[model samples]
Target chain A: MDFTGIVVVAGNYGSGKTETAINLAAACRKTGMAVNIADLDLVNPYFRTREARIPLEALGIKVILPDRQYHFADLPILSPAVADILRQQSDLTILDAGGDDVGVTVLAALASVLKDKSVRMLQVINVFRPFTNDVAGCIKIQQEIEASAKLHITGLVSNANLLDETTPEHIYRGYDLVQKVAAQTGLPVEFITAGQKVLPLLDMHRFSCPVLPIDRKLLPPWKRI
Target chain B: MAKVLMKGNEAIGEAAIRAGCKNYFAYPITPQSEVAEYLVKRLPEEGGVFLQGESEVAVGYMIFGAAGAGERVMTTSSSPGISLMSEALSYIAAAQCPAVFVNIVRGGPGLGGILPSQGDYFQATKGGGHGDYHLLVMAPDGVQEAVEMTMLAFTLAEKYRGPVMIMGDGLIGQMMEPVEFPDDLKTEPTNKDDWATNGMDTRKSKKRNLVKSLFLDPAALNDNNLALKAKYEQMKKEEVRFELYNSDTDYQVLITSYGTMSRVCRTAIDMLKEEGIEVAMLRPKTLFPFPEKAVFDAAAKDSCKAVISIEMSMGQMVEDVERCVKGQRPVEFYGECGGDIPSPEKIIDIIKGLL
Candidate 1:
């Protein structure tokens, strides 16, 4: 369960990468380690790590985001503080990347800084999404992300969810696909994510990695109902 | 005709390709962004043209230019983007250009939240843009229907040589369902050489053709308006489409709706029927023609005491229902806006009060 150094979370749109990154930051902080999150997702302004800034900051985790004036702007404005954090090499620095390779292209700017550092880039997979529904599809996305970000995916995180209707079977079904993907790609299943409600129902023995219980954040204003 | 699970937005993109529409111009907007995203990759593979315009306004004119050149073209956007394209839509209608515009409507007055809403009914059916013109608007209730109507939209647009709109809410765009775009529904693009702005030198005939909407002379303008009116009347007679449910059995109330709202009404009907309260539904597949006769005939049922218009808007379609009912039966309105969908239980409660 030791998550030290820089950890990056990457996935396709609606792949639950933001939630996974947020929960991963909280998990690292729970171990009494310094945590910092950079909202590197310039591709999607709607759902990004920046939306959970208040709570993460309250937990004593530093959150790096664009200037206040450009908070909602669609343009990519990577604050210099992100590079400073990468240089500082915090205990756990989680970079919540944007949806696809288009979003991950921003990460290439910091490739030189991250080259010598111990970096763990985990590709988050949500089986329910259109493009990443199969093993080959997941591999294609992995290759694309690696090509765009100029970084290698160290492991896989199974995050199969169906929003509000997600069930245990859905999680299990996604885990099966991720396992097949891991077998083909020779990557480890880092962990799986489930909603707090389904966490109690999941069989812990069925998974090889620890499970991360999600706290729903970054929901649309209308979906608050 | 292989069946596959597809979101409504992606299905519309696939349907346009199957309908021989290789030219697409659109700006990305919520709910309908997938259409442009899907086409960006698929169109280039099919040797078609796909361009993401700088804005919806620019995209509308791009479609106009392509359609004027006799190419099958389409564009997809949400409510606010459609509002930006209203001016071009009016000109497209006036010049009688054949193009399809898909509006996967979200809640709107300005830039509203990205959730399902049928608030664009008045805008689509009554013509949001200026001038005296109408775009043949088709409302599809589900993913499968959205695919079918998208394929049909090109045909209808070319048939009358005017703009056609496929209207659906965000629910239709985001939801996934198994669909098949039948090969039989594929249609050949209509010949546009007669009035199309294709270069005169390209054809054997050296007569130049202009596709402008302007009519400087009062007499010529009047004749143009009359011609457009005559075509609309012809459409009213030949193209009104609707679906009737439980019309055969005597019912206490008749619910009139379209698109996703009609599907909710169907569920409410089943729930009410379990309680022994009979209800009927008249779902309009075409919103412009409005299916006035079907609403009037459904309301004419002696046992049907009251008619209700259920929608996801602030009673826009209710006005049309009232117009059709003509005071023969009391008309009521129940709606939810800003992306709040009406539940079947809540609808059943409304039905109970009417009963």
Candidate 2:
């Protein structure tokens, strides 16, 4: 569960990147690793890592963002603290890179800094999303994120979910899609994520990688994991 | 078709295409911008037209132009963008053209935060634009309902020959859920040859079709208003759709809600049922007709003590709920806004306080 340096997560819009990033950070934190997560989802106005900041910070994990004034403004203002996180380097610095190439463009500015650091850029693939519904589509998203982020994706996270209605079938198919993408792209499948309810019913043998239990944090007030 | 996991915004875009609507013109705005993004690629692939207008104002006119020309047209926008299109909506309604407008409303009044809020209830239910007009508004509670409503909006727009709006909160535009596109809901565009100025030669007719909202003379304007009122009356009589939850037996508090807020109230009602407390909910699918009789009957139940309006705004829908209950029971209002959706627990607490 422990990772060195930074783990940047990026994918298409609505691909569960924020949830994956937050869960990944929490998993690392549970393993007694120092975790710092940066909220870089400027393209999305709702369901950002900042919404989970209170809980994440309460868990002793640092949540990085721009100044307090620009907290909820939905501006593409990447804070200097993001660079400092890359340089400061926690045991696991999970940079929740935004959705699509448009959102990942902010990470391009940190290309120079990423070169000197131990960076593991991970692409989250949700076969349920329109653009990334297949291997080709997933690969296209990976390429777009890499091109805009100016970094190569070293791993993939299978985050197939249908919010509240997710099932074990979705997780299995998601893993199958991620495996296909990994086989096509020659990248490692880092982990597969599922909501806590689905995790118990999933056939663990179906997945070759670690399983991350997603505790939804960026949900509306009425929703819960 | 098998159900697929889809975001509300993207599902709405696909619903429009499946419903035989090919023309989509929109400007990018938060929450609802995904609809434009999805259609920008998929529309052309279906041999349809997709245009990004310079602004919401221009986008609104594009819809009016296409709709007036007898084409099935749609545009999706957030609160501020919808406000910009309000003038064109009035024009389209006045001209008696069928146009579907989806307002994935964000927190509002003035460039409010981009989060779920039912603040646009008043704007959508009442005419956002000026001059006596009402856009047949439908408020969907979930992503699946959002898709269904988006598809139904097209047909309702054509049938009424006016603007139809699917008013949803930012959450409806952002959330993900499993949805199925019912093949039965796919409709062929109605024949608009009689009233459309789609070129008389195309319809093989000699009479010229005139489409305009301006009547110049006071008497003519009054007549047009009367005609519009007649159509609205027909809609109210035939298209008042609503769902009653937990009202079969008996309930002390009757909750009047719609869209995302209704879903929350439903969760609260179920949780309270576990605690031996009875609470019923009436969710309005069509906001225009308001389901007045349903609300009235539900409130008139002997077990019903008070009617409460639960919403994500500062009590916008309470006005309609109050009008519907007609003082049969004491009407109460509880709401939160600026992206704050009251939780099931908060609603439970509020309902318990009433008991």
Candidate 3:
């Protein structure tokens, strides 16, 4: 009942950011609040918001993205129209920005519009992935992304695991590492996404910010729920 | 009841509230992001929901889920974001899930520059997503229309149990204008337990409702497509909106336009009229299920030598005008892309050249 504003899911490649984004939007919508997901992942072509457009649309949630262009790969095709939609005073607007420092450029253009808006830009870290395994490495990546996006990283989303074989212990270890990064960066640890099954195993009170139980759908057909 | 000055995007947020909408979800893009920002604080105070989705894809599904619950929900985005939402839009159309969507369009081909453009005409009017479905698309010309159409979008969407789109461009979203909130904005709250999944208790024990677009069998999908086409045909009878200016007079030329481009076209038409030239203008309020009859009547006689389609794109809307004319008169096009708005004087010169 304490619905506030949008929840942004962002991180480096292979961090399962998009999957987290989709699940978070779904969970909130299931609670009877209107939700929208934006596809700002202009880096990789595969597994984007456009792919989920039909299912989301059937549910009546608004999805925003760039039109597919075969001829050009790197045009500043980010539409200002998305900004227009964000200005609406009624709906909650979430921005699924692109991955990594380069992908976060989408937020730079929105500096003026997001000026006074209560926005939270969280950096998602995957400990299993290289270069972000340690607390210092995650903080560095977060700082670089913040600089590139011209926005502050508001919080942390610890989602460290090996796909399909993650354990509750893995979630706890990932949480500890992210807590260090959050302290080093002076950003709060917003949320940690544990597989729905793993949620019951982890102590619910250890972390600050909400703990979101996520259902994975981005993996191959055999791994998806 | 009071008139307030607001940008088009902000107006959409206010208008959605006026229409009794309690939930809104979207992701931030340009031009329309202000709408999301505005609603973040306002919706909570009004006892509503405001959330910024993770991505356009997730934002769209959020809308889908909320509308299935029978809450008056809405979302806003730009051309590219709308492109992302098109798949969801197609499903909403087929499943007859009523909701409102506002697109503040900008230029695009890949990530086309973030300027105003009408390039999405084909996508908006002729179906952007896969599947044989047509959404009821309304194009607002000014801030007032943007607000009014958003309010009306909710009503029409619920009336048909399908998605409604308010398609405008950055010009409308950024412009400031005066507006009057209608005193009588809400009607009796109709229960949609028949299809909406608000709660099981809302309906008597019967069968569970599933709002889905999946039909493994080709025959079932074909039937659904045919049924959608039939509904579109019926909508043609019920939903053709337009505004005619100087059409009553003996016009020498016809101007066709919509949204912000149409407003510029109006300026040129007025200039030409001041010079004792008899020229008229027709603005399409409903971009989809376009006002074909109005177009035909405006270009009725051979007395009108030519028709001109003015827009923000290079010439997207011109294609529709050409179809409407069908060799009845010469049709021409003029536009400025990448947010470059064509001045009225430039449009006037183009009109003079056409004459």
Worst 10 residues of 2 chain B by lDDT: B182-191
Better of 1 and 2 by DockQ: 2
**Model 3 whole-model lDDT (C-alpha atoms):** 0.77
Candidate 2 lands at a TM-score of: 0.96
Expressed as tens digits, the lDDT of each residue in B1-355 for candidate 1 is: 4355567888899899988889999998876887887788788877899988999999989999999988899999999999999999999988889999999998878987777899999999999888899989999998899989999998999999999999999888866656767784455554676889888776557778889889999998888888889989998999999999888889999999888888878888887788888999999999998899889989998999999999999999999999999999999999998676787888889999997
**RMSD to native for every prediction?**
6.1, 1.7, 20.0
CA displacement after TM-score superposition, residue B189 of candidate 3 (Å): 6.0
Point to the candidate with the largest lDDT: 2
lDDT of 3 by residue, B113-205 (tens): 665678888888788987788889999998789988999999988887888989988778865555666654676347487778767766764
What is the C-alpha local distance difference test score of candidate 1?
0.87
Q: Candidate 1 chain B, which ten residues in sequence have the lowest lDDT sum?
A: B184-193
How far is B241's C-alpha from truth in model 1 (Å)?
A: 2.1
Off by over 4 Å in 2: B184-186
Give the winner by TM-score.
2
Off by over 4 Å in 1: A1-10, A14-98, A102-137, A147-184, A188-225, B184-187
Best by DockQ: 2
Q: Is candidate 1 or candidate 3 better by DockQ?
A: 1
